[model samples]
Target: MLKKGLYGIYKGVEFRITVDMDNNLKIMTDKKEKTDSTFEDTYQSGVYTKIVKPNELVDCVSVTPFGIIKGEKVQILQEKENKYQVATGALLVGSNLNLPRIDRDSWLGWVSKGEVKLFEEITPINPEDL
Candidate 1:
């Protein structure tokens, strides 16, 4: 049985497949939910990266309106053609100190492949320790 909140493609068109409370399969378009199907698991690891400088603005696929900032960290969720679906923090609504760090609150959107790069961590080494 097809799982709810998962994405699938049929007749070359992408769709968000969902199972209704009555167990009926419902296919919706242009809406991204929790896609956990193997068909959508194409990305290698949940690749996390930051938005490139001079941030390239692109229309987001979300229920709310917002803007992405340069250097903001995001997790690459899926990729289609030249675009990548990413998950990032939503707009700060209250005190920054009390911000919740959870997946349920993450903002999911799409970004061009050129607007992001794979993140790399660098560590300094002392000559004496070398």
Candidate 2:
């Protein structure tokens, strides 16, 4: 079980679970702030705060550079070294953990609409490495 600020993968995406000074649990996703309505709405739609185990709400997964489309999993190779291709929900690393970037693109669109069972283990990653 993790305490306070930590990052975990939820449904193939990364999320930061934070405990405020007041002890209120806050689940944060990439690009969405606590104050964002989309964030609040997504948070409200799930249950994780009551669980004692971090895995109960999230998991750790490898950085999947490829994803499936239609029926085949395609690799998301960058057209150039260190180039950004705008992947929605692509697990990104930087100043903070980032979720895959979702947009109107067909590939990204497929990822955003996909679902994983609550607490389902996708890819287990160490918190420190996150």
Segments of candidate 2 deviating more than 4 angstroms? 1-5, 30-38, 41-56, 60-130
The C-alpha stretches of model 1 lying farther than 4 A from their native spots are 1-69, 90-104, 120-130
Residue 53: error of model 1 in Å? 45
The pairs that clash in candidate 2 are 60-123, 60-124, 60-125, 61-123, 88-100, 88-101, 88-102, 89-100, 89-101, 90-100
lDDT of 2 by residue, 1-130 (tens): 2112355655555566665576654556445322333344436654333212444455644443443334333344333333323233333321122334345333332123232111212355554332
What is the TM-score of candidate 2?
Answer: 0.25
| lDDT (Cα, 0-100) at 8 in candidate 2 | 62
Reference-based lDDT, each prediction? 0.40, 0.39
- What's the CA RMSD for each of the models? 18.7, 14.0
Clashes within 3 Å, all models in order: 0, 10
